[model samples]
Each structure stands twice: as structure tokens, then as C-alpha cells.
Target: MGGDCESNVENIIEVKNLKKTYISRGHVTEALRGISFAVKKGEIFGILGVNGAGKSTTLNITIGLLTPSSGTVRIFGKNFFQHESELKNQMNIATAYADLAGNLTVYRNLKIYALMYNVPNYKKKIADLLESFGISHLADKWVGDLSAGEKTRVNLCKSLINDPELLLLDEPTASLDPSIASHVRRLILKLQKDRNMTVVFTSHNMPEVEEMCDRVALLHKGKVYMVDTPDSLVKIHTAPDLEEVFIRLAKGELEE
Candidate 1:
């Protein structure tokens, strides 16, 4: 059908047979074992997994930060490696593990990234982003002086400096309190809708994943266990919720 074909062509990111192996001190550790998935345009796709499940590895590869041992990543229907420079301009990531410069003021940090991305009217862009996150008052404050939640909000503001088409968020709400996390989630959804952005999200919070993701990929021990809507996965697995499904997958009780 024409509609089906159109939808397939709209996949903004296509990862094929992705694998990554790390060799440390003559010891080999497989971080990814041929995982593949596609993120459609204007949708929030979640990658769900426990620790060491290859979620971060997959994201690293997708962003061209890590070279895949044997795989192909296509973004905007072009080979990602071949067009990494151009592709990177259209993508940005926010992760708890990667922090902004601690010595810089919040505004200064965002300004540096905006210049890197060559964003126009960067001052206004930064101001609006900080305002949206309700942290405009922290602009003059040193990043090191901010609390964990405030720092997280600043990191998020930096990620949007480019107004990227593809946004990758890894454990985005990890350190925020319940109210702030909830507000962040709502803001993300609004941004995606307003900008028609394609988002790749990874979070350990099952309920949050269910609430935010349009679809989810469950990764277990470096392989994809399943991919489906959250409600559908729960129904198919006959589980009470995504948390239970995650538990079963992690414990290897749902192995195919």
C-alpha cells in the first residue's frame, strides 16, 4: 500500500546488524551482538534495558561516537559514517553521564555549544530554552554551584541549542525529583510535537517509558529481546506492566 510504503520511507534512523566489541587488556567483551532497529520520523522511540544490556553502546554507535565492529547506520536515508559531519549537525544528545563544563556559567556553556552548532540568534535560543526549563534565573550561576536537578536541566538546555531534528536522551530524568522529572517529561513531549522531532530515549523507569515512548525496544544482554508498543508488549507477555516485563527479560525468564 502507498501509505505503508510512505511510512517505511519515513524512518529517520535505520540501524542494521550493529555489533560492538571491546578489547581491554587482551580480554574481549561483547557490548552489542547484532542489534537492529529503526526510529521513525516524529516519534519517540525508547530503548529499554538493565545495566550492561548494550543500550548505551547502541546509542553511542548511532551518534557516531563509537565505531561498530560490523554494522551499518543510516540516517536520513544516508550512510551515517559517510555523512557523520553533516548528520551530527542535525542530532544532539542529553545524558546524565555527560556533564557540562563545571567551571562555566550556565549561559556560557550553552553559548559555546550553540556556536559549535552554528545556531543563529544563539543568545535568544539559549534564553528561551532556559526559560522553558524554568531555569532562566540560573543563567548567571556557575554550573558547579547548581544542584543535581538544576544541573540536569542545564544539560537539557544545552542539548537543544542546535534545535536538532533527532534528539537522543539517555536517563534524562535520572537525578530529578518527582515534580521536576514530571515537568521535564511534559516539556520533552511538547518539544517533540511542536518541532516534529524524532527522539531516541533510554530510561530505566518502566512507567516513564510507557508514558512517553510511542514504541520501545527491549534489549537484553546485547541483543534485542522485543520491540513493540508498551501496552502491546505487556499484553503479549501477559505481564502487569513494563516493570514486570523488564524484570522477566533481565532474569532471562522470557527468552525465546
Candidate 2:
């Protein structure tokens, strides 16, 4: 009930009892403490948390980039770690944390990824993505030389080249200007509408979450403070917007 479970297998991402901890120089830090949530099909599920709220940790484990300290993360009903190739085929991750090969041109970068995924008609697919994002002009330029905004757009294109069933985005539009950010948001919403893609995105921008997500979970101190529809949560919490609720949760005003 907390996360719209029991709705249908229409649910694309299912996470249960997930936990992660870091031990650096014998100092134990619990990053994610028993987190649980699920994103249904065709929804832009938002995970809102401040810095070090374990958003990146949760994403890393879910995408199998980092081994979990404990618990499970499933994409499209299969565990990511157990079914690497298949889960990867079903999912794609995009974040600023990812490294782009400095030597590769944007076109080369995507071409390599497309080939890796064995995406059919790779050349045509690449063309389509470039045109979709209006990045064709930068195709031949080295990825390292691109502006941050261009690189961000390219990163999105890289994740989307395979047309994944589940897309993970972390602060996707963080560095872009307002107009570009708006365009990026619209593109994401369009992807959700047109492809019915299940998305789990972490963002600090409340209005963006309110506009893009059907549901959101506010995380703080390695715990999910609440999960609900933006409208419903706003009404129940008596807040004018998500930002206010985020403050309440982040400040430890909510119950554990």
C-alpha cells in the first residue's frame, strides 16, 4: 500500500528491504537503512532527498553498479545481479556520475554503446537519437570537449539509445539552464508518455518532481519519510508544494 504494490506486474521496478552501508577506515556509515519502494509501469517515480540521503547509493545498488550490503533490487521482476544481461537489457542508467571516454566522439560513444547492446540498425538508431536531442552537430566532437549541458544531453542519449524498459536518472537536468532544463523535462515526460517507460529519478527540484512524477518518496537520514501522490501528499500535509513537505521530512519532523 505504501508504494502502490499489488497494482499489477505492470510494476517494472520492485525494491524491498534494501540496505547499504559504507565502512571507510573502520568508520561505519549506514547509507541506506532498510529502504523499500516500488515503481509501477509508465510512471515517473521521484525519489527526493538531500545530499547523502543515500539516493546515489540506492541507485548504484539497484543498477548493480555497486554490490548491495544487503537486500534485493529487481528490474522488471528479475534481480539485477542474478540476471545481468537480461536485467541490463530491461534497464538503463543515466547520471552525471558516469564517466564518458574523453577520447571518443559523441557519435563514437553512442555507436559503441549501441553495438554493445546489439541494438538493431545501429546507425539509423544513432541518427535518430542525435536528431531527437539535436546533438547531431556535436557528433564528431570529442565527448570531453563538449559543454556540460551538451554532455548532459549526450548522457541522456546514451542511456536511451537502447530504449530500455526502466530508466534511472539522477539529477539529470541539474546543470542545465532553465529553458534547457524545461526542454529536458518535457523530453522525459514525452518518453514516459510515448513509451510507457518506468522511471526512477532522483532530483532536488520540487516543482520538477511535482510536474513530472505521478508519485514521490521523500528520503532523509537514510529512510523514506513518506510516499504518496504529489496532490494527495500536498493536501494531507497541508503544504502548498512539495518543497515544504521536503523541509519537514529533511529536518526530522516526521516519525520514523
Candidate 3:
């Protein structure tokens, strides 16, 4: 499924008949079974599914962290595999599971990534990012010594080091308290709007998905179960909210 074609919106990411299979110990697991979707530029697209439904597998493939068993991934209208390095330079990902160096100070950690990205005037970029995320005071502190919320802020700051056109976030607020999570959500929204950046994220929080996503793809048993806006899915499924839609999908109560 793809975004509105009538509007002629440009697709920043297009996944076509994507499939990924793993063979281990004479056992086979099909992580993705011909799932296809397109994410429009300048919009937040969410991938929602229960565990083992292939959410993470799909994201990893799109980010070039994993290869597909079959099918294709096209970023910016070009074959991703043909220009992975160049494409990756325009993308960055932030995840609590993908931690920064624990022994390094926040500033140092960011500097290392900035250097890797070959960011010009990296010091200024690092300083500006820390300030923007309200983590400037934590810059000198060791990443290992920071609180969970603080670390998340720093991770977000580092993600922006390259001024990426596309930002991928995996459970960006997974372990934070409500207040901190709310703050992080606001900051992400602000940055996405201010920069007009494309975002693809995976989150189990239905409310968060509904609040932030312009469109969502619901995966079930390694296939795209449905694709639509949260509100539209609710109405189309005759459900009360996105959470109910998710539940129905997970339980196989909804049909394609």
C-alpha cells in the first residue's frame, strides 16, 4: 500500500514485495512475506505490529542494516543497494537499543558521530544540537552516568549530527517516565515540522502513533494488514480507536 496518488506526493521510501527469510538449524522463519508500502516525503509514517509480526525486520531492511531475501527497497526513487552509502548519508536512526558509547562524555560521543558523517564545523553542530534538545548541560557528563531520559535526549541529538533528510526512530520513548516521554514527543514533532523531514518509526504505543503519524502500516503475520491514517483505520474497521484496531488485527478479527 502507498500514500495518496491523487495528490502526487513524492515517496521518499518505497518497499516492493519485500521479503526476508532466515534459516537456522534446519528451521526457517519468514520475517517478511511480500510486504509493500510507500512513505511520502515530509510525513511521519508508523509501522505498527505485535512482536514477531516483522516490524523490526522491515525497519532494519529499510535502513540497510539487513538485506531482504527477495524484492527491492528504493530510497529517493533509486535502488537502495546501488547507492546505499550515499543514501545512508541522508538518513540517520535513533533507538534506545542502539546506545552511544557509555564511557564517552555526551559531547565526545556526538563529536565522534559528527566526524564520521564528515560534518562541517562539527563543534558548532554538536553544540547546537545539544542546546536544541535541552541537553547542553549534560554534554560534559559521561553517557553511562546519565539518566535514561538524558541518554535518550543525547541519542536524539546525535541522530541530527548529519542533518539527515530522513530520521528513523525505534521506540524513541520506550523507557521514559510520562513527563519525559511527553517532552521527547514534543521535541520530535517540533524538529520534524521545522526541518520538514521524513520520519519512519516503530512504536507499540497506539496513542503515540495516532498522535504523531500522518499514515500507518499495520503488519500481521509478516504481511501488511492495512495501511491508512489512524482515524481512518478506526472508522473503516468500525473500531473505537487505533488500539482496538491493533487488537483486532492481532487477533485476526479484521479481514483484508
Highest lDDT among the candidates is held by which one?
A: 1
Global lDDT scores for all candidate models: 0.91, 0.84, 0.88
Off by over 4 Å in 2: 1-8
* Candidate 3 local lDDT, 48-147, one digit each (tens): 9999998889888878899899988888888899999999999998887778999999989999999888999999999998887777899899999998
Candidate 2: the clashing residue pairs are none
Runs of candidate 1 exceeding 4 Å displacement: 1-7
Candidate 3 Cα errors over 4 Å, as ranges = 1-9
Q: Each candidate's root-mean-square deviation in Å? A: 3.0, 1.6, 2.0
lDDT of 3 at 138: 92
Candidate 1 lDDT tens digits, 160-214: 8999999999899999999999999999999999999999999999999999999
Model with the higher lDDT, candidate 1 or 2: 1
My TM-score estimates for the predictions, one after another, are 0.96, 0.95, 0.94
**How much is 140 displaced in model 1, in angstroms?**
1.1
Model 1's alpha-carbon lDDT is: 0.91
